[model samples]
Target: MEDGKLTVRAVERALDILLCFTDSSDLSLTEIASRVSLHKSTVHRLLASLEGKGFVIRDASSDKYRLGFRIWELSANMTHSDDPALILLPEMERLRDQLDETISLYVSDGLERVRVQAVQSNQAIRRVAPIGARMPLHVGASSKILVAFAEPEVQQSLLASPAWPAGLDKASFRQQLAEAKSLGFATSVEEREPGAAAVAVPILNRAHRLVAALAVSGPSNRLTLEKMMEHAPVLMEAARRMGKMIK
Candidate 1:
């Protein structure tokens, strides 16, 4: 019984270490030790174990630890289970058919947004994002909408992080978020990926908290700014329908 208890405690401690990476991308041994209230030696040992398991990787130059691909693999697996992707697939397909452009569903994961599901556009020239693609939250319309409607704490946290957009200051970013909220959707043109334009709306839960973002993307030449605005109502309505269905 003591052995079992020790194992459980160890698991909890490891989880604590992993959770630390959610807010900060990299950490030194001392930083992690202070964050988890563990001795430096203990933290070092835990990090070693996690490293062996491919959960963390250390930078050779900085010696700071960052989350590894294993975490991304596990996260991708979770996106398949108990996620709204399945429920949103039909809607995505319908939206794709309507616009003849790509439709994707994105959810926030730490400081990034993951494309959980997507229906590619049938058009000869269109935007296409793979199902498991992960991208910075400050880059695209889908990600920005997710950030805009997120909890105030999350918004503030992201705004203050180094991952925040380099071109936009905190005040400007906040204003953009406010504008997205006021407009009920977000739009981007050649922001993240050149030649791609997108319009997105937040999918909210019954409590009106953001659950995900639904976006329509296509070639900028075809999906011009005017076209994006024209499709905003359709995307917003689809988002609302998804919110209701998921709730």
Candidate 2:
């Protein structure tokens, strides 16, 4: 066979291995080899390549293979009119009208939180997050939710940063993260910007891995912590819907 065809065959086989995990969360080398109908050695080789690219994760304890965060990252990068942003904008618009606030989607990038999408409130005074703007992961409702639900190693790395906000107690912050995870949503009052406040919820894929944080932001007086907590359910439901469509 030609060299190009050989490479194409390798690509197909690798993709097959990745697809096998859709039916099950974790698989062993023999299990994957059987599912893909390839030899164990070939499956192992493909999995190694996938692992190198962060496409798969091998648990040290169970010696099992599972999809990794890289898969979630690529899936979230899709763009089109009415895209991930589109899929959530209608719901966001409804939220904006109801709360008269800015609705946004935030995703973690390294140790930073980035605003990937947003729907602005029509009110003369409203919160806005420009697409691609980077915000401190430890500073706001959406930012905190993104970091709080992140994988443990990621959370540790973020918490250990020297840039942690002055005067904010780490112990109290840990308590807040615990509460947000327990309650399924988080709220902030002028934590990042003066006169600004927001509430956010985690968006998770079928694998239960966090995809992004969905948020509502506005002037602190209008988007009181109480009001945001009250709307938490609706935001959570919206997040649930958005997450279902991911991968």
TM-score list, all predictions: 0.68, 0.64
Residue 183's C-alpha lDDT in candidate 1?
97
Query: How far is 185's C-alpha from truth in model 2 (Å)?
Result: 0.6
Give residue 188's lDDT in candidate 2 (0 to 100): 89
Q: CA lDDT, every prediction?
A: 0.88, 0.85
What is the C-alpha lDDT profile of model 2 across 108-189, one tens digit per residue? 8888887878888888888866776777787788877987899998889878988777887888888889888999999989
lDDT digits (tens) for residues 1-247 of candidate 1 = 9999999999999999997875577999999999999999999999999999999999989989999989988867665444689988888899999988999999999888988899999987878677767788877898779888887877877877876657767786678889999999999999887888999999997778788999999989999999999999999998888888775
Where model 1 places Cα greater than 4 Å from the true spot, the runs are: 1-82
> What lDDT score is found at residue 39 in candidate 1?
100
The 10-residue segment with the lowest total lDDT in model 2 = 79-88
